[model samples]
Target: MSELITIIASLIALLSALYARWTWSEAQKANKISRLNMLLALKQHYSELMLKEHEKARAWGKDDSYAEACRNSYADYQIKYRETSKELENFHARIVADNI
Candidate 1:
């Protein structure tokens, strides 16, 4: 009877451990997926901003006087886009590294 109880206890422990690990893995996967989605959205936004900035640059290039102002604005936007892009890259790298 003692041996049977011990065997049952061991099985229960093993099942508990497996449940914990499975829950943890699922949470981790969800978090990583969320991050990846956020990164993708940011990338899309960055692309749109770049497209707008390029259009502004092209328009201003056709006019000598407005060139400087347009260039400066585009520069600022470029900096912002770059920072966001860097963050996205970091998120993607982390997800990949964790095999998520």
Candidate 2:
């Protein structure tokens, strides 16, 4: 009877360990999914913000008075803005690719 009890206890312990490992793996997967969702949300938010800013800049560029205010400055801003937009796109793409 004692030997049978010991064997049962060992089996229970083994089962518990396996269950724990499976739960941990599931938790890690959940964590990864949440992380990806967060990244996607962030990317969408940034894209919207960038679009808003681009529209504002475009409006300013189109306005005769604003364009007349500082043509050189506006030109420089447009160049830098486009470059920054490209960089942000590349960065976000890389992040998503690497994570996935």
Candidate 3:
């Protein structure tokens, strides 16, 4: 009877270990997904804010001695604004696709 009880205890311990392993694996996978979501959100937000700032900069031109420099600076902001807007759109599309 004592030997039988020991065998049962051993089996129970093995099952418990397996259960713990499965739970841990699931939790690790969830953590990775959560981290990816956070990174995506951060990227989207940062890019959007940068685009907004660039737009504002173009609206409010800098005071410069050289007219050519002023036009060049405004042109730079215009280019960055368009690029950032495109990037944000691409990222937004990706996030929507990921959700689907």
- The C-alpha RMSD of each candidate to the native structure, in angstroms, is 3.6, 6.3, 6.2
Q: Is candidate 1 or candidate 3 better by TM-score?
A: 1
Candidate 3 C-alpha RMSD relative to the actual structure: 6.2
- Rate residue 94 of model 2 by lDDT: 63
Model 1 ranges with Cα > 4 A deviation = 1-14, 56-70
lDDT for each candidate structure: 0.81, 0.66, 0.66
Q: Over all chains combined, what TM-score does candidate 3 have?
A: 0.58
lDDT for model 3 comes to 0.66
List pairs with backbone clashes in candidate 3.
none
Q: Residue by residue across 1-100, what tens digits does model 2's lDDT show?
A: 9999999999999999999999998886677667656655655655565565556657776757555544545555566556666666675576577564
Candidate 2 regions with alpha-carbon error over 4 angstroms: 60-100
Give the total clashing residue pairs for model 3.
0
**TM-score of each predicted structure versus truth:** 0.62, 0.60, 0.58
Predicted candidate 1 versus true structure: per-residue lDDT over 1-100, tens digit per residue: 9999999999999999999999999998998898778777877776787777678878666766576667776777678778878888898788789876
Model 1 local distance difference test score? 0.81
Model 1, residue 86: C-alpha shift (Å): 2.1
